[model samples]
Target chain A: MRKKGSYRIKDIAIMSGVSTGTVDRIIHNRGKVSEEARIKVEEVLKKVDYRPNIVASALASKKTYKFVMLIPAFSKGDYWEIVNQGIERAEEELSGYHIEIERVFFDQYDKDSFDKQMEILEGMEFHGIVIATLFKDSVLRFTTRLDKMQIPYVLIDAFIENTHCLAYYGTNSFNSGYIAAKLMYQQIGPDDKLAVFRFIRKGDSCSTQVLKREEGFRTYLDENHFRGTIYPVHIHADDNEGNRNILDSFFLLHGDVKAGIIFNSRVHVLGDYFKARKKKDFKLIGYDILDENVAYLNNGLVTHLIAQRPEVQGVNCVRDLFRHLILKEKVKKMNFMPIDILIKENISYYNNYI
Target chain B: MRKKGSYRIKDIAIMSGVSTGTVDRIIHNRGKVSEEARIKVEEVLKKVDYRPNIVASALASKKTYKFVMLIPAFSKGDYWEIVNQGIERAEEELSGYHIEIERVFFDQYDKDSFDKQMEILEGMEFHGIVIATLFKDSVLRFTTRLDKMQIPYVLIDAFIENTHCLAYYGTNSFNSGYIAAKLMYQQIGPDDKLAVFRFIRKGDSCSTQVLKREEGFRTYLDENHFRGTIYPVHIHADDNEGNRNILDSFFLLHGDVKAGIIFNSRVHVLGDYFKARKKKDFKLIGYDILDENVAYLNNGLVTHLIAQRPEVQGVNCVRDLFRHLILKEKVKKMNFMPIDILIKENISYYNNYI
Candidate 1:
């Protein structure tokens, strides 16, 4: 049974003594009808309030929206995959619209993989692009193409400088680092060293994002009159055996460095080192809520995980693109995810959700 | 400009060499069409892919959804107001649908005010409801009518027991309190006293949510085999001068109770007390991100604010109501919110746009 004050089209048609089609036509303003039928429909409509459809009208206009997300290729349940899950959620939301979203993969560490994806995308046509902006030089080339093509794009994971992107949706790397430093500094002494882990892939240049985080982390420590040394430790991103050699030697060489912070989502790499050694004591601050990071967090090896809302970024990239391109709405240029400080007590509420 | 590999109904009609009306009829299966025209539309349709619209089809079916959110009349920038903002956001998103949500407010402190609202609601009908089940007897009486009317309703803020409510959309109160205790337990010793603040309103009995929180807080301390005294301190929800007298005496009497935790959103009451006193040091853990609470948090009085995403609760309560009632979608009965631990460093990302 319908609630009071709610009327169906069939009910309105019955009240107006006409077919639902006549009522629908009068309501949508699409077709001609007899003046008598129109008046009858209008009389019923006057008592009712109905809003015209949103994206249905967009579909009616017959414009197809193609949005592509250029991101790193990763295994299931990794950082990028979680971001993809959010994009998939948004894709499900806009499934009815004449809109299509394609995810293009690149090797995060390999410039060649990135360049391959860019070359493949060279012949592609899209209404908008959502690029992860990982590799700066290669992205400069691709985004320049976007600028030349005049296709509005959003930058995710990093905020690239001097770009004409429609928006940037990611963490403020500096603030995130400052916050992570705040957490780490609370537990450490003025003389205790903090190891900043930078997991390296082949031929990978340090991103401006990572460097900004390092700068912010150092700035916080330096401003606090930290007498301890803050040193960088670069480890292989994929090579587990080689990583063991690097980390085992580093920890053995600098036993004073108990407090550590990884600037990337691969903080689990350090966790893996500890996991293999069967020791779960580390004041480590890492990034992302990946299952690996969380498992280490529960095991008490990782103290705090500063999270950027990748899922939110994924969802907003698609939505904001639609708003700007299809709905012609003005969009914000930068949208930073919140710096979430997750401890063992508070991490359950924050499982890949905004 | 349109993206590649997408088509509109007009384009499909053009592809089929038929009028848009014939194409629309075949796409929507609305009207009787010539078999030849249908065949032509089918040929064009086979080359394209489209998922039918979600809510627009509900509109096409012509059902009006009337939802009512019966909540406490709160001041601007308060908890309920933030929830209203989330609800308003959802309302804007659903502006194209045939649904109208009405918010009815009542005096939170007055049982008569609640009864008066119940009386007003008695004459009205709703397709579904989102009620802030505060007063137990009053909600029990009101929900009995809902059961009689066969109208589904969702619970917000506090999950009342033994109610036929469709779902709950708020923090798991017990877990929230347990987490708060963990934070407070970090600073206090077994010999130290912990004050559990219960801000009392007129004609108010302790809510089940608050009691569960109290139970959880004590259980955590007890589970740890603590010898600390955990006691309740009842103060007025309103009477400021009386509250000042009560608190001044309580502090004078028990100087050992430096650590405090307020279970409900009205923790700002204690913050206001501290603000007036210009006291910047209190190991106080409160709930919600009220401006008063956040200001005190910055000033170093309130240490942590456990934020239940009232805004997210507001957004979901409406959307879930629509999903269950209008869209006929299966909805889970218990939708607990993430218990967000808001500190001075992590508070920036939480400006209520979740």
Candidate 2:
């Protein structure tokens, strides 16, 4: 038995017959020590058992870094709000280190908005940037500028593979798509017809997440050997008229479709479409937990939601940025967020931040 | 916008009329250029946009580190097993860095066993340590020695104050207790007398999670403004004879007590007690998802079992260790695992790894 807090580095040094400076240098990894001395020092220190006081270390350290987040603004009932909450929580926790978070939100629905935001960002100086890869052209241009400026940045929610970015942290789109497909595959028998509804905007910027998800969903069905007629329909997500026209034409053409899967955030329209038509038995699965989607889930219209921890993804983007710039640390090239399967029974327990 | 991946540091240097060596030195912080040169270089670099390739950086960097885990050994169930799973996952993810994990598991039922483990650990070398602080005396000695040695460690599952640790990641015990109390509180009305059982082991190491849970459960009653008499009983968790004797006498003495709560993992014995008597409808709440407890929960004997993400905690412990050791990253000192409320209807959905 030993008294609490009785151990000290000086004691280890004294017992080992080593200079305190040598011990300090070894602890801090300050170089220039003989191999024999280094081994002897480490051995004696291990024998005594040493642990650093982290609180004192934190307080004594004067390192501070700024992490900036540039992403889509949180609209009413949008998923980005959840992501903002996660970012706020991370910011509060990291406040101890004097790490500052500067958030800049742009409209995902508009390309000019991204360019406008980029123009503003070009004039400012930041240590690191965490941006959602929403508008590819603007992102590439901004990230290219960031690269030239030697400012480290991480991509969140979506990634652009060809460009040089510090790191990427978001959902593994393919795995999540596969998980969703598995769920649907289990739910429906081999004889049932399946439809994948992708709400694509006409002349809109491409979203890599949607493409990856569609590819993954298709791959699952192919791999699982499902013997059913599969149909895919692409409609403008933001245009209700476009969605209705395409859906109407498709349903009229193929009235035998028993189940539908929406590959992206516009699943709410499917819910609205199905609910209005009173098509109760058509099994449906989609992405996210929008209020409209939750309403559909509660009403038993939506069978499942393949949720990406968008909030944690947002916060981690900032955290990773700080790690790269402030700590001068090596950032991971790709970080896949967990794919949370949210059902009506379990949605209430889902972490509010996510 | 700009051609994809066409930009590089050489282009920026060419555009700026500065030597590539000067630009590379500036980016890597070699510190030879004048202030005017640095500002001029930064301006041109920003105009053309140069991004460092992370793939190149990851390939070029050479670093290796050691992470050690000190936790309780897997006992009758998967309490520590889930955590080990998390650790192994992190190890796999970090395998490319030449990083290593050295795990030393100690007996939870014996303080002397833990002390011996600590003694053995004191003789070893590690860059970081992740400990499940189950015993006070052993942990205090271990942590103090670690502090003296200037080795940073993180606390998981259980935490102690007035000591140095890099970070703590576990569930909020008091809040969990409050949740337990809430669960049991809902089952019984104010007229009923409640009992809290602490399945103790005379001289063995017990967790503060138990005590905090008890406190939180009690506080729930106080906060909810309920009127109920609460009785706490402590008995050896494994002593069936002693437990039966104590319960028989206690029931005989306090016949009015209709509901009970186990602030620890001894819910199985209570289930066994009830099964022996063939008792029905006495409100019960316990902890974890052990096989015995799961049987009880499924049999309608246990009303609510509060579950922390045991597997996630285990996985995060390793990830945290790696982040601290390899990346030189600072981890959160106290990461409160999500306080998940598990019900029969939602348990399956909540079981996925985070």
Candidate 3:
């Protein structure tokens, strides 16, 4: 009955002496069909062994899909804005397909805000959801609810383990850290002391992303048998005085530190501190293409940037959701972004792509 | 008249007391309409500010578009095969949009083969063409013919200047070279002699892409005031005995050369040569993610590979052609690819994206 896979719905219809619409309705179990037509279509279907393509059938159907994107609120920092722009581009490209995107923004610094938004989303109905944030506990609880509701979700930017996500689209944080260490290794000697800066808000634990990066950095140093002492400094990001105090104490304690690697995007804070003191000898490597970081990179104060393209992450989040929900396409579990090594000369091209 | 951006074909059809199909036909200048319907649509077109989106209209129309893709023939070297995979992906995505892609292959090292393919293409009619090759003279003549024929074309993999191409999708060879130099700079000193290796066929001149990369590499060295003498070595790619002889001579003359940069993807040849001799002191930088090169990178023989994603380039070549020909979207002149710096730790993620 399966034959050579050359039989289509039209062929079935022709064989059944029925219209294609009638055959489609019979196959989909939608729309009323005459008994005679239904029986004829069923007979042809059974004889021809037609297996419908779920993706193609879904596309052929006139069904509207709604996708909700949960992300951090826009701020003066252009990172999330660029990400939103990527989502908008996907929305525009998918407009003709009867797909709608609803954006829900939560305060990046507030776990309660995320919980409140998820509560509101629990009351609504959407085919799929895309989430991008670092609120681990809240996301874990919400994903439990999503699991109970059988709603598929995708994670962007930061991935959490032990969760049932449709897909994860982001950078491999540990690998990025390992590569950052390699870049720093090129400039430093075996015995040269290096500083690891982790900037965090007061009372906030370092993000899993940042922690993985630090682990990767340390692992690289260990595996390569580097004799350098790694001085770890935690700066309270919310208080300038506290940050200054931490930096001052770190410098006084580790005056021999020749290079620094920031585990997060706030490398500019250290760059500014170094610049103000006219410290030209210390080399730094950090993450992201935030304006301050790029400025520091151009100033030669920040040597290299490990760019995990946030825009690409956002775009793929929406695209993967579309594929999973509307097209019924199989999505890869992990969509790791390229770890882009950005310098002054190549930033323009990278910017254009993003 | 232009009150707001709210005019649509349905609105015109409503006001003009015509069916939407009639309005569409009148707007697109397709499918004959009654004289009365035509007059009404024309009057509405004159009165209200209605600008038909050329792209949407083209998509809505029943016209089928044909695109020709000219690329190097695939061999055991999977570079062009990956590119063809990208093109095939695009074709599959655009299959429902009435777009047909005709792929024509040319021998990589033969100008006559390219010329023959171009002559055949000139005789046929295609809406657009995407070409990837560095046969400069043949391309210039073919592009002139394309210009006279009013066919828009795109260049991928290698870009030529002062052509009437719709867009160029590939790495900026010079910037890639400069960045490669930067990567090398991190591992070399002021007086350390470096060698530049260009591997080409016996009779073929150095490709424009390779030459530009060499220029960029030299420019970086000059701009930074490097005092090292650059030894340039050209090996006939097809002659193994000749390549070994040349490498032996190069080593004998420049035994102090501690670093080398390959201007093309054939860096694996040199890597193998060096590895067979148990030479581990030379830090090498090369281009592309060809299998042998990645193996060398994993084996720690190749320090870095500058990946100008051929797959991404091929994908964009088709997409940009679609935008220009069918969508009537504004395509940027130069679509420079990001110079992806690949090390062992991050190459897996980059490979996944590719």
Candidate 4:
């Protein structure tokens, strides 16, 4: 017998009359060993001085991996820049491994734009794909193609439950909205009416976040036994004319609506519209950052901004992809980055995330 | 010629008259080739097209790594439990790469305990070590020995400025304390007297964190134009009787003392002493999560707890160690996790990290 804490797997292997692979398999409890062989191996292992040399083993066997990521480009108010920042952080930290990333960015708004991007991607081979698709039709079509090809992929920022995906990373849009509703409920009394404004681009189908957020907002009110009326309105995201008309119609209809919730990034437009009209104060909650949103956030027009660390989602997705592709590691199927509640006090610290 | 977007690196390599390794090196800019060779390879790569096959590459190279972790054990009432939780999380996520972690825990308060642990560790070979040391002299000695032996190491939750550590993961102690003092200065007036309380175990080394925090707290007071007597006190962490006498004497001597700050985790004892005597409120700031401190926080006796995600530190340290051992990656010499300000409203969220 060796001295205290001085034993190796080679000794165990020699004693057991087994190969090192067989010994390792037994140690890690990998399946497919004969009962007789396993018993013999275990009997010898109990007597011998044996421990795995982890560092040398890792160095000798370290393999390289590669992953491919395809997502919407951060253009025209796309919040992908923050997500890219998150990806970069993960990349810089994980650069030592053989894991590499290939990225393709598609336009956010147009369906044909996705098709054009897909045309460029069909021939490129990859272990996995990470995508944030705004339109259901395009997402389904692309996902189906991947499924048929048997390529593993993760969805970031948004997820489609119907598709076969390896994993997802994003905030639960509905839960965030529900939480926001609860926050408003605490400050506003039973007599107040709440309105939800959704600014969606015309024909933009990746409104899953908006729809889920709206559901969560209403669910909070319903669950809390609140007797407040909730009004939801959808306006063209970038159309000032449509936004103005919807705002006018909603205010004219309610006249007493005290608090408002804007689902998605167009909270800025609502803030701008209100600021232009010079309304002093109306408790408002919104999603994402635009120049308009920050202005409202600072001026106290936007009471809370439900920030989903977009950059973190981006960074984490890439990190997970690296793990899956390079390490042949099992990545978590559903990775939910926290729903950060941002007020003016905490907003400055979080300004650089995305 | 193949259809658009239908070609891969294999086709490019075949046309380029170069090995796939050469092609990969060119793509990554690893730069070992002559200019003429590089130009020729690029010319052929452009002609034939080169898309990466991410999956085949991952599957082909099935590498596993071994990491060795040497950390401080959770002594009775020690907050290192939170740090262990972080390490476990990183391990769970890293299991896919066949990355196995062998952990050895040493007592923080005893030098002989660490020596005994290190003696056992030297016989058992490892690629890297991640440690949180409280006994600075022994630790620095061990670190130097490890460096001489050519083993990589990462330090967390402390600052040993002169050492050549592979990485340091924790708070920017001085800045964190300075920020805390600035926050306190906002509430306390210029005429008010402030007291600084440092709770330390008898015979413990005066750590960089403690010194830096004290320096920062004092600097803030000086810079803010506060004209008041600032008294500093260091008391035995476990000596309740001695601590009480010092506390009572300080209060009696300076009855006009308006605020106090605890540099370490000794606020619990102070909070308890005050509670026993029925003093409910004090503008107090302390560090870490001891049950006594939490009670004071809930009751509003302690104004704030400067939380430095201990769990995150543990997790990141192990992760860094893994990268060094398994992936052959170089880690940063210093990694400062953000200093989080914990208040009553956000204390519940701390459970996630723990």
Candidate 5:
């Protein structure tokens, strides 16, 4: 009889009086085995109560795994560049384990570019995929295809619910907004008017992530019975003139608006505008610690900047995929990164991770 | 002739017309080798420009490493308990790689207990050590003997300067204090009176960590030209009546003290004191997110709690030692953990790491 917890396939085979291949076939339910051999193997399995060590099994298999990453092109800015750096670090660390990562980038602002990349990915064979789901419709369409092909994929940066994604590593946009509102509420009076800035590409809808944040911000204000009027204005991300025009009009209409909150990392634009105009009275809260935003914070133009650790998100995406695909480990569906609050004092330490 | 990067000791042995062991002996200067073989091996090394991969070398050596952890007993409180949990996680993860970790805990409040533990450790043979240096004099003595034995060690929770430690994974107490002061300064006016509380056992001197924090806090106030009167108080951690009496005397001497800063996790004592007196006007800031402190923060009694990420520190201490001893990697001397500012809103997310 096989010893409990010490029964390898060979041991099972010996106990069953069958070939090792027959034991393997019986265990994995793959290939054909004689009924008598199968019955004996089953009996041995029940007697031993053998549990496989998936990690050891994976290491011993000696099979190479290919992971494909579909992310926004690094040409966008330091944001994507930082994420790419994290992915590269994970790739290098896992290289000795016979895993290869292939990166495919698409223009973040263009649907057609994303579609083109998705088409390329459809023809490629990979064990798993890691994607930055910026374009919702495109990602949903591609994820459907990925599901049909039985290819597991993890999402980063933006999370969409009711999707077939194996897991997601990103921020909870609504909660981040709620946190921003809480910080803002602490510094502002009940009667003070507030301005909200949302940056989007021309003719493009504001991303679901941004919209959720705005909604959460509004929810907090409404729930707390905040008496201040909230004036929200959207400006094109690349259009300097449009940004200036929107801000100027909003300030002119509500001159008493003492504090402003930006929904995204485009807070630098507002910081620069405030500095040029010499508006020292306005308190600003923004998201992310991009260089420009931090500079603005240092200069006292931006009062508080909420940080989402993009690098940690990137690293976890690769690690989660590796665990699921190679080690047969079950992965959590959602991994929400901590919302880091960075003022001028603690930003230096936060910068060390990237 | 060996290639530039692929020169192994086997190749060196072949070139020197000796056994690989002889080549290894020549390379490491560990064992006696014939003069001719040493000279030939040196010549082959110079010719090939061989650079050894320490990780691969350690793996191939098949050495089992035993690491000893010296820290305060977990029975002290949640702080040490959290740290022990982190160490356990690392031990479990590293067990597969033939690494064994033995924990030795001492009484945090008693120097003699620490010394006794050190005496036991001196009689043991361990490859590496991870220590929480609670008692400075005792730790210095043990570390001196450890250096003589050539056993590498990492420090956690508290860092001592100019020590023969492989690395330190902990908070920079002074900087955390400075950050705490900065946050306090923003909320209180320059004319306001501020109270500083340091809790300890009766007749116990405040730890170097706590004193450093107090120094940093004073530095910020002096540098910023804060016009506030600073009230410093110390209370016995377990003596509730003594804590109340001390606080009452401080407040009666300077009733204008509108804000208070506690230098350690025992801020909960002050929180309980404030709640019992129904003092709503005082703004309180403290260090750590122990259960009582978080409850106070949630109830709006504690305004801010600076988190040193003890669990992360624990995990990193073990990981750094593993890299230094087993992988032969050069670890940086000081690893200052991020000072996490926890308000009630973000505490849920921060709680997920442990």
Candidate 6:
């Protein structure tokens, strides 16, 4: 019949027949307190499940801290823009706690932009940072410096191994890829030909998510012993002539492919290519829900989409990072974002804010 | 570069060139402030977007509230049990704010049990209640009394219309059904035979979600001009002989049925029947993710599931009701939950808490 509640320090003091100072000292493990008084205070605390109110504590200590977000420079209506909106939401929610968040973006297609941003971050004074690990080598080096400075950091979008990350908030790339294959189980048979299409710009950026997703997809097919020929094609992004040459070669060679998967957020590029040719009956699956992808999905150009909840991921990364910085709370290290399977039928019901 | 935040009352008063008491009175719409003072305060409030801090105000009031959850009696591993867990989560989150939740259950299959529970509820002194609107007539009548009593209530699982409820938290049943039919578009063609299955016990409980889902499902097929015949069947629940007879007749008549839909959480029962028969090529879509249903899903009996986020609905229902009651805030009437599409591959990614 009792509620899951905590008693106030005053209540604990009265119950333990001790002064509030002794209880406070015991609770904080600071100053000094007698062993008998500590045991009595500990007993009362245990009995009442004495969890201090986070909101009150946050307001009581008016110490201000700064956190920075290291992400890709994005235009409006892009995936990074959506992530920025979510970060803004978290910033608003934590405004009363005096936690300031500064967003710093680097060009995802250029390693020089990453180095430039990292140089700026090196001189900035911040308590914590959230990174979208686009450039693996640059980010790892920066994280090493962060570890030396004792600054906690969170990784989003993708992660690096052997780095001291406070937590990682993103989709499990391998599982998402495996699930993409699973979605095609009812449609594509064993003898059907499958393709993996990836669009990339020239850069030394980390390809962890891309490689992991495709690996998972192939692993599923291999594990199921799918009796089909699989094809993988890489197209140059944002280079019209280069992409055209690459894609023309792919279509001429693998036009008979029954199904395909795009490992990145630009499934729309494939949709655009197919739209011009009026392609039909070719099942296409990909990642994220850009508006172009939704239009393609509705028109049946794209069969299904696996959304990584970019906004949701951004909100959690900042919120949990703040919890650790301000309240000294322990956060789970690997907080995987949900992999939402979206079709034209169920897309309206998928909530990114959840 | 400014954050989305509000200004303090002191700052507002100083800006308006008035006393803090005058600003407070103007803000509260009380104590007959002068026209000039009111104008100044109003202008400053609008300019500064003076939203009062919910947490600070909540702590200052130090008032307590009692919210009652009137739901179906739940076993340890049932759908209702999952909803209960969500309610407990919300209850614990609000514990620091002095809000207490009391759970009251009623038999879902018996009208008399509902009546008795309603009588007990009517006699209790509660700030608010969250109801699982199972029985339409009885619930509507009770809502009328609640309106007169000026006590707010929220409807979960399903809702009854024409009532002054504070809010309704559940999936939009029609959209869920329409989406269910959409899931079958790739598998079941226009010429495939489909069946709608229902299990019921003798009672006057309202079947809003069931009827709406079926209606939506049919609407999709009808809109598409499906050439297949859809057979609807009802089996008596908890009556072994009656269910056996009904199912036997159904199997004798429609042994070649290619697809089926269950409008409730008992898809596992159908899975159980098909298990022994080793039925293949029959696509069965149903609701919820009970352990039994998940087992069948993993074994390939249940093809896909559309989940209503039952626990998420419960948590929101209670939390929003508390906000409306204690914070003097306005709440939206209809909060439709996301309709998550689940398969064996992506089931682990579904988060009820979010």
Best by DockQ: 6
Which digits, one per residue and each the tens of the lDDT, describe model 5 over residues A1-354?
323454567777887899998887777789988888878888878888967666556645668889998987864455777778778777765654657789998876676787899998878889999988777888899888889888899998879876888899878889889989988887887777898887665336556677888888888888888997888777775788878888898788888889999887879899889998999978999988788888999888998998877777777788888998887789999888888888877776653332
* Per-residue lDDT of model 4, residues A1-354, tens digit only: 443223456557787888877877888789677787788888976665444554334324556455667776775455777677677777676654445577787766566777778778888777777888566677788899999998887888766789878888877777777877866776677767878776555354646766787788888788878887777777774589877988888888877888888777767777887888777667888877655677689888888777766776777777676666555568778766556566554455443212
Pairs clashing in candidate 3? none
The most accurate candidate by TM-score is 6
Candidate number with the higher TM-score (2 or 5): 5
Give DockQ per model, in order: 0.26, 0.03, 0.46, 0.05, 0.26, 0.51
lDDT of each: 0.81, 0.74, 0.82, 0.71, 0.80, 0.82
- Compose the digit string of candidate 2's lDDT tens values, residues B8-109: 667667766788888888878896997876887899767656556553454246655678888878865757876787788777665545566888988666
RMSD in Å for candidate 4, one decimal? 10.0
Can you tell me which runs of candidate 2 are displaced by over 4 Å?
A1-80, A83-354, B1-25, B29-41, B44-63, B202-205, B223-228, B238-256
> Candidate 4: which docking quality band?
incorrect
**Which residue pairs come into collision in candidate 6?**
none
- What docking tier does model 6 reach? medium
The C-alpha local distance difference test score for the whole of candidate 1 amounts to 0.81
Scored against the true structure, residue A161 in model 3 reaches a CA lDDT of 91
Q: Report fnat for all candidates as fractions from 0 to 1.
A: 0.34, 0.02, 0.62, 0.00, 0.29, 0.64
Instruction: List TM-scores for all candidates, in order.
Output: 0.82, 0.51, 0.86, 0.54, 0.81, 0.86
Q: What is the C-alpha RMSD of each candidate to the true structure, in Å?
A: 6.3, 15.5, 4.7, 10.0, 6.3, 4.1
For B1-354, candidate 3 gives per-residue lDDT tens digits of 323223678879998999999999988789889999899889987787677866545645788889999988877776788788789878766764668889999877677788889888867988999988568777888899888889999998778977899999888999999999988988898888989887665336556788899999989989988998898887875677788888998899878999999987878898888988789989999888988889999888899998877777777789888988887789988888888888877777775253
Q: Arrange candidates, best DockQ first.
A: 6, 3, 1, 5, 4, 2
State the DockQ, from 0 to 1, for candidate 5: 0.26
Better of 1 and 4 by DockQ: 1
